[model samples]
Target: MTSTKTMLTLAVATAAIVAAAPAAAQVSGIATAAPDSAILSAKAFGAANTQIATTYKAQLDQATAKQTALTTQIRTILDTNKDGQISQEEYQASQVATNPLSGRVKAAETAGQPAIDQLRAPAVKAQAYAIEQVALKYDAALQAVVRAKNVNIVLSPNAIQYAPPTVDITKDVIAELDRQTPSVPIAAPANWQPSQDTVTLLQQYRQAVYMQEMRRAQGAQAGPAPAAGTTPPATAPRAPTGR
Candidate 1:
């Protein structure tokens, strides 16, 4: 299992790649497709394919209910005076009462977080697995789209300096993915770790996307060069060098 930090890094890198291209370029390219260049919205594609909403709806609802109940109980405890609103002093007092050793208010308040996490771990793991499966499906779908369109390069919409609607194969890729993988099993093994191949591919994808985005951003920030034949503005001759 990849650590949460690694997952966050991958997500950030991917997002950066998608955001690399200048908006002006994309707008200008809307009329024509650059040879072999294609843009896609990975975020949208992932959202469209995620099955957690349907597969874990019941569990999510239960979790939400539990959270609400816990919140009410905590609030009741903090409002020691039975007042409708809890004052800062009352809250502090409750915290001190709960854990005198450590004066950490949040720690005392969220003591049940560990228990909540334990309860949801299975569902969380299952949802993550489903998303991973969808990602794999997305890769295959993207490949098929690339072959069909005879495209040599695929870029996230964020990375494109310019791209025409004609070159955006996101819809096509989504359609293909839906056709090939309409649903994914949300059940995850008790202990799941992605295969080495999957890890390598995921890492490569994150790095590629991040680098492309960074390159495009740098280019965009590099303002246009002085127009050809334009006269350079003359600076007052540097004050005659002191004798």
Candidate 2:
């Protein structure tokens, strides 16, 4: 199991590395989008998440029902004192005997969790991979928008002070992302390893990317039009520059 986890981790690390390659400053910024670029809202991704949530809710219901049944059985066993009330001592003692039954139920549930997880794994994988692909697609679209605008820097919509709605290509990129595939490919073996630095780098990169997405979503929720000519609020101070 540990080996499997390690392998899966490595595969994710690899994908993340590949994704980050294009972000290097050296990568050519020669993209182009129409002058009237669409603004892509982060909320658009929510459209694809309903199915995933439904799947998880069903699994949780099953788990909860199983737990409820086990609780009833345990209660019945502890009601042994016949006083219509389970004494604390009785409850504690009965717990040991009832524990096996509970354990059995739990073990079964625990065992079943993996199966349920396995069943859902592919969908989850696909969703994540698809999200990444969408992000990449957005990146490309944004680059084009910048090039067409004749801008050297493609500032995040939130970061830019007062760009015209027409100048913000966020919407167009999001639409394209939605139309594109949103499934993660599951090639990770149930074995794979790389250097620790690689893993750390991947984790950091993923966190940063997630933060960026979150900020974009927050900005989208906070307004209709950005305040004209106002830069993004100052970000929290960063750690001292690294080598």
Best of the candidates, TM-score: 1
C-alpha lDDT of residue 69 in model 1: 59
lDDT of 2 at 51: 48
For model 1, residues 1-243, the per-residue Cα lDDT tens digits are 333234345544544544566755433322212111211233432443255545555655665556545555555545557765656566445435455422333444356444544444454455445445666556566667777777654544544455556777767766776777766666756557654433444334434554565466448754222211111111100011111
How good is model 1 by TM-score? 0.47
Q: Write the per-residue lDDT of candidate 2 for residues 18-96, one digit (tens) a residue.
A: 3456645312332222211221133333443444456455654554454445444444545555655545565455336
Query: How accurate locally, in lDDT, is each candidate?
Result: 0.47, 0.39
Worst 10 residues of 2 by lDDT: 233-242
Question: Among these predicted structures, which one has the highest lDDT?
Answer: 1
TM per candidate: 0.47, 0.31
Clashing residue pairs found in predicted model 1: 18-158, 19-158, 20-158, 21-158, 21-159, 21-160, 25-162
Model 2 / residue 103 / CA error / Å:
23
